[model samples]
Target: MERLTDFVLRHKLAVVLAWVAVALAGTFAAAAVQDRLGARFGAPGQPAYEANQEIMRTYGGGLVPLVAVATEPVDFARLAPLGRVVTDPAFASDDGGTTYALLYPPQDGDLTEEITQILGPHVRVTGLEALEPEGGGGISLVAEILIGGVGALVVLAFVFGSPLAVVPLVIAAAAVLAAFLAVYGLTYLTDVSGVVQYIVALMGLGIAIDYSLLLVTRWREEGHDVRRAMATAGRAVALSAATVAIGLVATMVLPVPFLRAVGLGGVVIPLVSMAAVLTLLPILLATVGPRIDRGRPKPSRWAGWARRVIRFRWPALLVSTGLLVALSSAALGLNLGEPTSDSLARSGPAYETLAGMREAGLPTGALSPIPVLAPESALPVLRAVPGVETAVVAAPGLIEVIPDYEGTATVENVLASAPPGARVGGAVAQSIGFTASVYGAFPPMLVLVSLATYLMLAFAFRSLVLPLKAVLLNLLSLAAVIGALVLVWQEGHGSEPVWGIQALGAIDEFVPAMIFAFLYGLSMDYEVFILARMREEYDRTGSTDQAIVRGLGSTGRLVTSAALVLFLAFASLAAAPILQVKLFATALGLGILLDATLVRALLLPALVSVMGRWNWWLPSRLSRRATRRAPAPQAGPTSPAG
Candidate 1:
């Protein structure tokens, strides 16, 4: 750490110029990166995905057909030129004024407008794709980043109270731009999700700001001694970034292509943020840090709060544990699946069309017709399945089954009843396959992440108990966050009032995993920050009580400030029109706030206080092997507070 800091300080000018060039190149690449971004949510090798592949090979489109509803009878002959158009007598409402047709256009093109034009003004189109929230393009992306950046600036000003506040933002911008360059290069190798862009910009902003904030705060605390700050806080920043990377990289273990791509792309955010913090930030601090850091430091009340908590450790522990447990109970009701069409969009042309369909007593399931590749003889069998509204042969050896509802049960029943060698593929089937494939492998992934994180924290802290405590607390924090998500989104307790989005009935399938991947690492960042300080004080003073007080006193504000920055970034993300992005953002924002306050501020300190010397325990054999140094000191007489 000293050598790196020395090198950065020695070549400050060269480092600044190099980063300026990279940032400029990245600024130019950012616009081009958006064009290369795309979304794919298929589970390769899964039954439904393989079947959809075959179906798409035979017919241009196979996943879900676009539904066109009109006041007049739809002309199937005119639509034939667009793609395969299938209709049944049952597709008409009982009132006979409304009729709909399913159009399977080539997957490469959209036929919604063409079909709407062909059917005239009374025509309304609603489908799985059509129901997605609109206008979440590059404009919204820039708006969100700006809003988040403004919020972060406010928080930074409060923290630093000087022109120095802008330094973190500068570091964040450079890191985010650099990550854009990496992602742009990544696009040529594989298709990256458009979602990655939002995450890279917003999350990268928060993380880079956080790393820079920690280092700068430490440097100031050390009387502008850059070497001391780099050796102490710099190590914490590196560990925090590594943990974040571990959490994101764990997502690559899932079989889903889009998720693996997301994991691959997300890993870049932290790496670049760390790079900027370690290299670019130090240079800025050495060169311009003294000039800008002219504000008087304010006195903090966190020491008194920490002392009080340690004084009343028992009450603090019980109250914090109770609150977290109460919140975590909501996760028991979490349902993972795609949102219903009604929850996809609230006020759009497609939304109005779906409402009209429902009002006319048209089955909503027609919006997600199941396509099966099988002989014509299997059509009668598929029709006989319960919950199936009707079945018709849409093409040679292809049967389309319209169910009463789009659900896993319907897809399962179709798969079960289909003849040997038959393949069933549709939106519901694909969703089910995705849930099964992603979650079926989740347990092992969780184990891998936990084990890896535990070892890393243990080595960094050189304490077995502290690392274990950190891991368990992180998990508990994540569970409470998920519970909050269920309450806000799935149960609609606050979603409607807060975001104006109705209850989704079920959380998006990928959301929970994404939340875990992100929040686990981010929440741990606080753990690393607070506990690293605690461990440092413990080593210096050999008094757990003093360690708790001094550590919390020193880092409590920093943790809160960092959490607020991240929360604001995610809050900006919540403003996006996309429902899935909204859910992801809201959950992460809530998680950061909750973990920073309840878990880190209350439970973590109280628990460490109650545990006393046990919190620092490290077995001699393991400590020697892990740290290649002397084992931790044996527990002495307890402090009067302990």
Candidate 2:
């Protein structure tokens, strides 16, 4: 590590140039690729995939398609043009024969109208239909998902208060543009869907910026010079980022094609972005070395306060543990269910349209039906189960039913739905044994998967107690965020006149699980990163108190900075023209801030204070040889920012 830093210092200019060139090339390539990828994985214009044309036309409103009709009657003069809106090139036919249309979302304008005109009359116009483009519900979802993200940036700006802080954001923007362009160019090589590209863009940008923020901040804190900082921060962040990338890649283990695309796209972007941060960011810092320190305020009272808290061990521990347990219990009360489109929608063109339609008494829930599969007319037998409101055979071997909505799918299964929450996924799959079909289990399965993931993370961390603690802490954070979301979105916490978006029904089925998986992993990332540093400090100087104080002081700024950057990156997704995307982005962004500030900074620190020597008191047999080494002196020089 020392040697690598030395080399970087010696060759700062060369290193910087190389990184810049790569970023530029990558940027160009990514731009080209994004266009190609958009052509390949972009939203389907129709529901059919024509190998001959090498295109997949999208159909319906997507996922649960929204079928709405505004009271306005079709005008004979405008019918021809209106038909184009419904049959635009963006709307494709599906095997299900579902009628679909793509509106020119106002954000994407001219192109949408041009496409709508091209389709010409084979389409139908619906509620508050506009020939001018309008954003989609998915975009609104993106906005909601990003709420916490924007807040995080504000928090980050406050935390770092340094000009260098902006560097991460810069690196992030360049990395994202490069990634999108590269994905676009790849379209020429293979068929990529437009929607998939957007997903990739969201996942890639969010993760890349996060990785960059972590790398750059750590680099400055650890290395003496720009180049050295780059090398030091690079190695640590690379390993950490790789771990996250690996986890994301693991998503391919599931059978969903869209998710697979998301995973693949996610891995590529972050990896490349890390490379840029380690390389170009250092060079930029070197060139603007002194300037990087501009706007950096002298350390604040919070730093001193945090340091003091670490020193007074017992009080900190009690507070942290008590809070953790309390919040963990609240997390237990959290409702697990699918998120609805309304839950995702932001106050935008798409949301406004949806609101107007809902006010007209249209069922906004759409077709979020639960499918029950049984061989040879078993719907009658299954319907006997409690909470199974009105079951119908939607297709051969498929039974659709309305859930009681009062209990989780797992709860309903036990009382009347399927089985206990624990048995809902694999157990249901095993019990049905190819005889019955299902759909709504996706949300339930997601929760189970996340639970299993937490177990794996616990094993990876090598301490049952700590991992368990981390999971519970994460749950508390998630619960608080989700609960707030539910109240605001479902119960209409602050609606009426503030935002204008009414409370949608239940949450979307995919949201909780998605949030759980992503946020849990991220929270763990932070826990491991911060804890690892503190443990390193403790190993050097058997003084847990000093270690916590020093460790937290050093990494606190970096961690908080990284969290802020990640928040901004994800929050950007809210700009997307999709309700689900907006919601997902907002929720995730918020979760990160909560995890970094409340959980990592306050709660985790307090617990360590209480634990003291016990924090590092692994059984002698479980302790590794390295951990047994003589303690280093506590007077080593602190790492600097550039």
Report the number of the highest-TM-score candidate.
Answer: 1
Report the poorest 10 consecutive residues by lDDT, candidate 2: 47-56
Instruction: Give Cα-based local distance difference scores for all models.
Output: 0.87, 0.50
lDDT of 1 by residue, 1-642 (tens): 889988988888899999999899999888899889997777889988888888878877556678888888667557777777887676788889998888888763456678768777778788877775442432488999999999999999999999999999999999999999999999999878999999999999999998998999999999988889999999999999999999998789988879888988999998999999999988888778999998977787899999999999999999999989998999999887766686677777888899898899888888878899899999888999888988888889888898887666777899898888888888778888889999999999999999999999988988878989999999888899999999998888887787666677888789999999988899999999999999999888888889999999999999999999999999888887677898899999999999999999999999999989887777788778976878766453562434
Off by over 4 Å in 1: 70-74, 90-99, 105-117, 120-139, 341-362, 625-629, 636-641
After TM-score superposition, the amount by which residue 215's alpha carbon in candidate 1 deviates from its true location, in angstroms, is 0.7
Q: What is the TM-score of each candidate against the true structure?
A: 0.93, 0.62
- The worst-scoring run of ten residues by lDDT in candidate 1 lies at 633-642
Which digits, one per residue and each the tens of the lDDT, describe model 2 over residues 1-642? 456556665788787676566567766664455445432221122111121012111211111222222333222223233222222211212222333322222222223233335444332333212221232333443353345345545654665577665665566656666666556555555455454555455555555556665655555565426555654456556655654564455444544344445555656665767666665665666677466665544463445656777666467666655654554454433433443443444555445655544454433322233333334355565556665544454334433443333223432353244422211111122222211111234445545545664555433333334555665666677676676556554555633233444555444434554465456556656776676667656666767676677677767766776676667656566456654555566677777887888778888877766655555543334344323443232222241211
CA shift at 285, candidate 2, in angstroms?
4.3
User: Predicted candidate 2: what Cα RMSD to the true structure?
Assistant: 10.5
Given candidate 2, what's the lDDT at residue 11? 84
> Candidate 1's error at 208, in angstroms?
0.6
Regions more than 4 Å wrong, model 2: 1-18, 29-166, 181-223, 226-232, 284-297, 300-303, 307-472, 494-499, 618-642
